[model samples]
Target: MIGDRLKMLRKEKGLTMKEIGEIIGVSDAAWTKYEKNRAEPSIESLIKIADYFQVSLDFLLGRTNIREPQFVEEANIQSEFLKEFEWSKIGDPSQMYFLVENLSTSIRKYNEHKVTELELQLLLKTISDVVLYFNTLAELKEKYKSITKEVLTEHRKTLSQIIEDLNNILEEAYKDILDGKK
Candidate 1:
C-alpha cells in the first residue's frame, strides 16, 4: 500500500525516483526497492516519506482512506475518545472545518499586519491555550462520564477558571494593541 501510494504521489507530482530519493534522503536503488515492495522502509523513513507526500501514515499504509493526518497530542487516546463520541451529534462537523480555516486565516492576517513579536507570541500562546482548554474538557468528559452533581460543579469550576485566564490574556493583548495605536 505504502509503495503504491508513494509511487502514485511521485507520479502525480511529476518527480523522478531519483528526485524523490534525494528529497527523502534515500538512495535511488532504495527508492526503487520501496516502489517494488521488495524492502520496507523503517519507521523514520516512512515518516519522512509521509511528510514529503503530505499524507497520513494510515492512508499510506491503507489502514484508512482519510488522507489528512490528525493533529493530536495522544492519537491512541483520541481515537478511543472519538469512537465513543459522535461530535457531529453535539455540533455541526463542518463548523470544526471552518474553525481550522479561521485559525489559518487569522494567522495569515496577523502576518500581513506585521504584528510585533510580543503580540505574535501572545497570540500563539493563546491559541495553544485554547487547544489545551478544549483537550481538558474532552479529558474531563472522558474521565467522568457519570457526571454527578459534585463532578459537574468541579468541571464547571475548572472550565470557568480556564476561561478567566484566557480572558485575562486577551485583555492584556487588547491593551497592548490599544496602547500601540495610541
Candidate 2:
C-alpha cells in the first residue's frame, strides 16, 4: 500500500524514485526496497520521505490517503467569503464567467494548503508560548485535556480574540464607507 501510493504520488508529481531518494539522502537500492515494501524506513527517515514528497507521514505509512489533515477548513470558508466579495467587485456580466474561473483556481489552492511539519511546529510553539504566558490561570488548567491542551486552548483563545478585533475593525470601516467618510 505504501509503495503503490508513493509510486502514484511520484508519478503524479513527475518525479522518479531515485530523485526522491537523493533528496532524502538515501541510495537508489534503499529507495527501491521502500517502494517494493521489502524494507521500511525509520520514523525520522519516513518523515524526511514524506517531506520530500510533500505528503504526510500517515500517507507514507499507508494510514491515510490524505496528505494533510483538515487544518484549513475554516480558512476555506473564509476564502469563499472573499470570493463572493470579489464577484461583487466585478460588475460586468461578461466578466462574471472569467471571475468565476479565476476564483476556482484560487479555491483549489486554498483547499489544498497542506499542513507541513514546519507549520505544525510553529503552531505548537505558538501554543506553548501562550501557555507560558498564562501559566497562572488555575481554572484554565483544569479545563485542559492535557498539558498540551492548555497550550492549545490558549492559542485558540488568542486567535479568537484576534479575529474578533479584525471583524470589529472591518465593521467600523464599513460604517465609515456608509457615512461617506472614506
Candidate 3:
C-alpha cells in the first residue's frame, strides 16, 4: 500500500527514483525497494516521504482514502465510535470533529519534529488503538444490549479503566516527548 502510493506520488511529481534518493539522502536502489514494497523506510524516512508527497502516513499506508493531509478525518473516528450505535443519531458531528481535529493536529505536529520519530509512531499507534477499541466496544455493546443493568455497568467500568490506561500511556509519552522528562 505504501509502495503504491509512493510510486504514484513520485510519478505525479515527475521525479525519478534516483532523484528522490538524492533528495532523501538514500540510494536509488533503496528508493526502488520502497516503491516495490520489498522494504519499508525507517520512520524518519517515512516522515520525509509523507512530507514530500503532501500526504499522511495513514494515506500512504492506505489506512484511509483521503489523499490530502488534513486533520485525520473526524468521520473515520466518529464512524468507528458509532458504527454499531443503534442510536447513532445521538452523536454530534461537531463535537466529534473538534476532538479529532485537536488530536490529529497534535499528531501532525509531532510528525513535523515536535517529537522524536519513535515517539511520533507511538502516538500514532496509541491513537489508532484507541479508535480500534472504541469501534470494538461499540460492537460489543450493541451485541449485548439485552444484558442486565449490572452487567452493563460492569462493562462500562471495565471500558473506562481501559480508556484511562490508554490515556495514561499517551500522557506519559507526551511528557517524555514534549517535556523531555523521560
Candidate 4:
C-alpha cells in the first residue's frame, strides 16, 4: 500500500522516483526500492521522505488514505491560501491579486458544481481564518518596519520559520493529491 501510494503520488506530481530521490538525497535505485516495497525507509528517513513529499507520517505508513485529515475542498482552499500568503510575504503584488482572483473563481466553481452548503461553509471559514492570520502578520510587519537592525534580523528569522511551516503544509497537500484525496 505504501509503495502504491508513493508511486501514485510521484506520478500525480508529474515527478519520477528519481526526482523524489534527489530531493531526499537518496539514489534512484533506493527510491525504486521504496516504490517497489522491497525495503522500508528508516524512521528518520521516513520523516524526511514525508517532509519532502509534504505528507503526514500516518499517510506514509498507510494508517489512513486521507492524507490531509480534512475534507478535500477545504484542503484545496488551505493549500491555495498558503501559496498566496507565501507569495505575498515575498512582496509579490501580482501573486496577491492572483490569490484573490483564484479564491473568487474557486467559490464560483464550487457554486456552479452545486457543492453542499456544509462544504462551502468549511471552505469559507478556512479562507477567512487564513486571511485573518495574514492580516495579523501584515500588522506585525508594519510595526516592525522601524525597529533596530538586530530586531529586524530576528523578525526575518521568524518569517523564515513561518515559511518552513507553510512548506510542510504544502508537502502534506501534495501527499493528499497523491492519495487521490484532492
Clashes of each: 0, 0, 0, 2
Q: What is the lDDT of residue 77 in candidate 4?
A: 73
lDDT of 2 at 41: 76
Superior candidate under TM-score, 1 versus 4: 1
Candidate 3 per-residue lDDT over residues 74-137, each given as its tens digit = 6565567745443566656566657767867877777687755565555566667667766766
TM-score comparison, 2 vs 3, better candidate = 3
Q: After superposing candidate 1, which stretches have Cα over 4 Å from the reference?
A: 71-79, 82-182
How do all the candidates rank in terms of lDDT, highest first? 3, 1, 4, 2
* Collision pairs in model 4: 54-171, 54-172
lDDT of 1: 0.74
lDDT of 4 by residue, 100-128 (tens): 67867767867787544445555565566
TM-score of 4: 0.39
lDDT string for model 1 (117-138, tens) is 4555666666676677677667
Off by over 4 Å in 2: 69-182
Alpha carbon lDDT at 5, candidate 3: 88
Give the clashing pairs for model 1: none
**TM-score, cand. 3 vs. native:** 0.44
Each model's lDDT: 0.74, 0.65, 0.76, 0.71
